[model samples]
Target: MGRIAAGDGESYARSISTSSNVEIRRRTRVTDIAQRVAKLMWQWAAHIVRRKDGRWGPKVLEWQPRTGKRSVGRPPKRWTDDIKRVAGIR
Candidate 1:
């Protein structure tokens, strides 16, 4: 048995290791998930546009809620805003 003391007046009991106490940490590779998501969003949008079925996906995407009063702060960002921005159109 061994006592591990810290500078904050805290002590902990640790067992003496008969085996190796080495810790191995491997580096994680970063992924471009944002790019992949954006690509997929564009593909889905294209598919929805090409659909002949009377689905509401395209309609909902273009739909806007009309109200008499407006909030004080900035308006919320819409999904189509991102798609339009990425498509290089205003």
Candidate 2:
């Protein structure tokens, strides 16, 4: 930018460099943000798979040494719910 502003025939170079964001979307071209978004959504769905111990974590029942105790109350929003909301799943 400095070099372009200081000399003639350099403004073109500066403008081209600055306008690249609009000309090319890096997320869609390189990494493909849509794919990453889907992967994340599936991970969220996996989070809702219940276990026999009344937990939202591991699928295996009593597979770990962690306590499976529950409180006498309602539960919070499930990941599956959010996943459905975002992906528009009924």
For each candidate in turn, give its C-alpha RMSD to the true structure in angstroms.
10.4, 8.8
Residue 65 error, candidate 2, Å: 25
| Residue-level error in angstroms, candidate 2, position 22 | 6.1
Best by TM-score: 1
On lDDT, the candidate that comes out on top is 1
lDDT of each: 0.70, 0.58
Candidate 1 residues lying further than 4 Å off, grouped into runs, are: 1-30
Task: Look at candidate 1 and tell me the lDDT of residue 1.
Answer: 27
lDDT of 1 by residue, 1-90 (tens): 244457423322122223222321112334467867998999999998898688898897898867779777988788898888998988
* Residue pairs clashing, model 2: none
Q: Candidate 1's error at 68, in angstroms?
A: 2.4
What TM-score quantifies how close candidate 1 is to the native fold?
A: 0.60
- For model 2 the local lDDT of residue 8 reads 59
- For each candidate, give its TM-score against the true structure: 0.60, 0.32
